[model samples]
Target: MSEKILNLYLVIDNGIIEEFRACSYEVAGSDEEKISFLKKNAANDFLSSFKFDPPVSNSGKKMKYKQFSRLEKQGKQFLLFEEIFQKFQVPDSPLICLTPVVDGEILSSN
Candidate 1:
């Protein structure tokens, strides 16, 4: 049987991409476990500068980490993340995209 797989993508300005892969077999069975796996296995450089938060409008509001996992699972776009990338001057303004890949398919980037 083919196990579920997750691919984490960090897209930067200048069209540079960094990818990290994790298979269900290697990670725990729970959603939280999967997130932990990605966190632990993600690149140090990515993690060092990574920021998890909603957009500025939603600032001061707390978004649950589980929501991020859900977005990944559903292959939904994260507008706030895009804004964050823009705020940090990730190169191409709003072109810095981050998305999750399931199996061999890439989820959409909002």
Candidate 2:
């Protein structure tokens, strides 16, 4: 059986997307989680210069390592709302993020 996974994908146009993924899969689902996941990953050089819209939240409740996931890749092709031209940017501001909350399976050891 395939395991459910939450994939956080960031794209950079370099002809080849030099693989820069989680240093540790222990990352959780809360914003309280350090986004430095990027800053600390190998893509830091290309990502360091751009500014993201809507100040991110590094506050409130926190989850333990490997406790939460959000890409919603539950063996499906689509999940929510209006058509978009991009896979990364929101169609508009996520001021309320009416989008669904996609909590995937917890990290498990078999």
Candidate 3:
């Protein structure tokens, strides 16, 4: 058998969503404070579409590269959370919060 992770992540700038690629995000996790932060900036539907589709570990993480490629119709490397975080980390920027992410799903099999 094989293991497929259904988890996904997002890049939250302050509270605003970077993009509404819900089809590009598959939800499940993110911090409550961050979620609350996002609530202040984004619409509720945007949050729900989290049933959209997208990140980083060998842990319970997912891949934005594949979904992003599929959604944006392009083949490029998925930006790591660290790189994305740096852009929004000017001290003036509130915070760059990510749900949680891995490079891809399907970690391993037996």
Candidate 4:
């Protein structure tokens, strides 16, 4: 039997999607490892397709890399939620609020 794997879908606001399928054994119960894997493998394509405005803090300033890393972790959480919602026929919501420009067309998930 083929082993079941977890699929991680990264969707840009422009409706571009990049999917990463990883074996459950690869993560080995480490969220950090999973995030690292996704970032290393998929971040370039995902980021290239969409403009990422750096997240801001309550102080209204751009957050640092550490904060961005935290956001990456949060993204993984949202990915799981989206996966579940998709399976149950629930409308999937945008995990991040951003306007994606694709092929001279502006797309917004809102």
Most accurate candidate by TM-score: 1
Model 3: per-residue Cα lDDT at residue 32: 49
Scored by Cα lDDT, where does model 1 land? 0.39
Of candidates 3 and 2, the better by lDDT: 3
Q: How close is candidate 3 to the true structure, as a TM-score?
A: 0.22
Alpha-carbon local distance difference test for all models: 0.39, 0.26, 0.33, 0.36
Judged by whole-model lDDT over C-alpha atoms, candidate 3 comes out at 0.33
lDDT of candidate 3 at residue 66, scale 0 to 100: 42
Tens digits of per-residue lDDT, candidate 4, 50-70, equal: 222333457966534344336
- For model 3, the run of ten residues with the poorest summed lDDT: 101-110
Model 4, which residues run further than 4 Å from truth? 1-48, 70-110
* Model 2 stretches astray by more than 4 angstroms: 1-27, 42-85, 89-110
Q: With candidate 2 superimposed using the best TM-score fit, by how many Å does residue 3's alpha carbon deviate from the native?
A: 17
Regions more than 4 Å wrong, model 3: 1-35, 44-79, 90-110
Q: What digit string (tens of lDDT, one per residue) describes model 3 on residues 1-110?
A: 11111122454333322332221222234444444444343333333534332243478455444454464455233343334333323222223222322232212111
Instruction: State the lDDT of candidate 1 residue by residue for 21-96, as single tens digits.
Output: 2222233356555555445544432434443423222455443445545666886644434544344433332222
Best by lDDT: 1
Sort all candidates by TM-score, best to worst.
1, 4, 3, 2
